[model samples]
Target: MTETVEIARGPYRAQLLALGATLRRLEVPDREGRVANVVLGCRDLDDYRRVARYYGATVGRYANRIGGARFMLDGREYRLPANDGPNNLHSGAPGFDQRDWALEDADASSARFGLTSPDGENGFPGTLRVEALYRMEEDGLAITLSAQTDAPTVLNLTNHAYFNLGGEASGRTILDHVLRIAGSHITPVDADLIPTGALRPVANSPFDFRTPKPVGRDIAQDDTQLVRGLGYDHNWAIDAPGRAATLYDPESGRVLDLHSTKPGLQLYSGNHLADGPPGTSGGTYAARAGLCLEPQLFPDSPNRPEFPSARLDPGERYEHRLAFRFRTAGSVDEAFG
Candidate 1:
C-alpha cells in the first residue's frame, strides 16, 4: 500500500508521498487569506506511475541529463539507460523518482523519506543511500536532498515540483506569471536538449530573466534556443548566494522565492505538461500549466570537465539544499525577514 504524510505550521501545509518521496500538495495563503494548492499534482499514485512526467518527484541518482546515457568517471565510462531521445534524463526510467521510498520519520511540521539504490541500478555506480526531508516553515517549505555512495559515482538530486502561484487548479497557464532569475548566464543546449558545455550570457536574449518579466513575453519568439527546448528548458548559472529566483502571480498576489545551495537552476517552462497525467484537480494539464524551478548541478555535468562537479566518492556526502518561501507581494519583507 502507498503512504502519505501531511505536515503543517501556522498557515502553511504540505502533503508528501512515499512513492519517489513526491511532494503531492502544498498549500499557502493568498493576499486575502484564501489558501490553495500551488504545485501541480496527479489524482493518485497510480496516475503518477503511468504519467512518467516526474511531477513533484525527487529525481536522482543524477538530477538532469547524462549525454549519450554515458559518463566517464575515474577512468571508467559508465553507461546508463537512454530515455530522453539520445540522452539520459533524470537518470533514466525506474530512476530514483520512480522508486518506493520508506517513511523513516514524520511529525507535525516535517517528514523524512529514505531509499536505497543498488549498485548498477540504472547503470549508475555505487550502492547509494538517499533521503528526502521536507520541513514546513511559517512561510513555506524546505526540501533537503542528501545521499552517500559506497563507490565513485555521479550524483545530483532535486525535487521536480512545478509551481503555479495562482493555484494548481486556477485553470490558467503560468504565461502571466512574472519571473526573475538571479543568473546572468545559462548553460546552452543542443537540439537534443543536452548542454553544449558553454556558459552563454543571457544578455539581450529571450533566456534573460535577470529582470522581472512575464513568462510569455519572449516565449513565442523564433529564438533558436526557444525552438529547441520548446520554451525555456535550460539551466542558469546562478550568480547569487541567498535567493536564486522569484516567481509572482500578479492576479493572486502570491509570491514564491527560491533559495538553493546548487550552482545551477533549471527553469523548465512545463512545455510537455500537456502530455502528463490527469491532475489532482481533475483534468489534463495544458502546456505551461505550471513552471518548474529546479535547483541542481548543471545538466550533463558528469561529462563537462569544466562544469561544477557532480562526482561523489566513497565516504563523501552529497547534499542539495532547496527552500521555497511563499507569501503575498505585500508581505515580502515579513515573510523573508
Candidate 2:
C-alpha cells in the first residue's frame, strides 16, 4: 500500500512518498526562515508524468555511467542502450529514476519503497530487488539504500536534489556560497566525461577544495575538465577516514553537510539549468542557480577495475547511507539581529 508522510516546519511543508521511498518535496525556510521550497521538484503527480529528467527523485540500478552501454560479466558481454553519446549513462534508456515504485511502509518520519527488476532488464543479467528508505530527522534527512540480486549485477543509487539555500526563487546564483570538500584527489574524466580510470591529485588543479572556497572561484579556469563538463560536474575522490563535505551560506547562516560511505561525490553546479520549465519555487530556473552533490561509486565503475566494485550477488546485500544535516550557524536572536 502506498503512503505519504507530511513533515512541516512553519509555513513550509514537505511530502515524503512511500512509493520508491522518495523524498518527493522538501519545503523549508531559507536564510530568513521565510519559508521557501528550495528543492527542485514537480508540483503534482501530473507534472512528474510530463517531466522525464527526474527532479528531486531517487535514481538507481546504476546511478552514474557504464561505458559503451556494455560490460562483460563472467566473460559474457552485455549491451545496454548507450543513451549518452558512445557511453551508457544512468543505466540506459528506461532507468529506475523514472519508474513507479511499490510502497513497502511509511510513518510520520520515514518511508520505504521497493522494486524488483526481472533478469536482463536494461540488458543487465540478474533478477534484482531493491529498497530505498527516506528518513526525516530533526537535523535534516537521511537516505538509506539496499539491494540484492539473484545473479551478479552492478548497482549504484543516489538522490538527485537541486538545492538553493537563499530560497529557490530568490533570484541569486550559488556563486557566493562557500564549499569545502574533504578530499585530495579526483577521478579525471575523458573528452566525453567518462572516467579515464585514473585518480589524479587535486593539489594544484581547480578541483582542490581542501579549504573552504567559492564554487565559482576558478570554475571558468582554462582547465580541460572544466571545459569538458561546462563546470564542476565531475566526481571528487574523498580522502580516507571519510566523513562529510560541507556547504555554507553566510548570508542565511545555513549550512548543509553531506556524509556518506561512497568513494566519490559528483559536484554539479547546475550548468545545464534553463528557464524552459516552471520549478517548485514558482520561478523559472536559471543556470547555476542550484547545485547537486551526488555521493556514489565512480562513473563507469564496472569498467574501472581499480574503483570500488558495484556488483551485488545472491545472498549478498548492497547497502549505503547518506545524511544531509542542516544547522544554523548562530542563535535565533543573533541571526535575526
- Which parts of model 1 are misplaced by more than 4 Å? 330-337
lDDT of 2 by residue, 155-187 (tens): 888887777776677788887777888888889
Best by lDDT: 1
Q: List the residue pairs that clash in candidate 2.
A: 69-80
lDDT (Cα, 0-100) at 234 in candidate 1: 91
Candidate 1 clashes between residue pairs 3 or more apart in a chain or in different chains: none
Model 1 agreement with the true structure over 72-148: per-residue lDDT tens digits: 98899899998988899998779877899999999999999999999999988889999999999888999999999
RMSD values, in order shown: 1.9, 3.3
TM-score of each: 0.97, 0.91
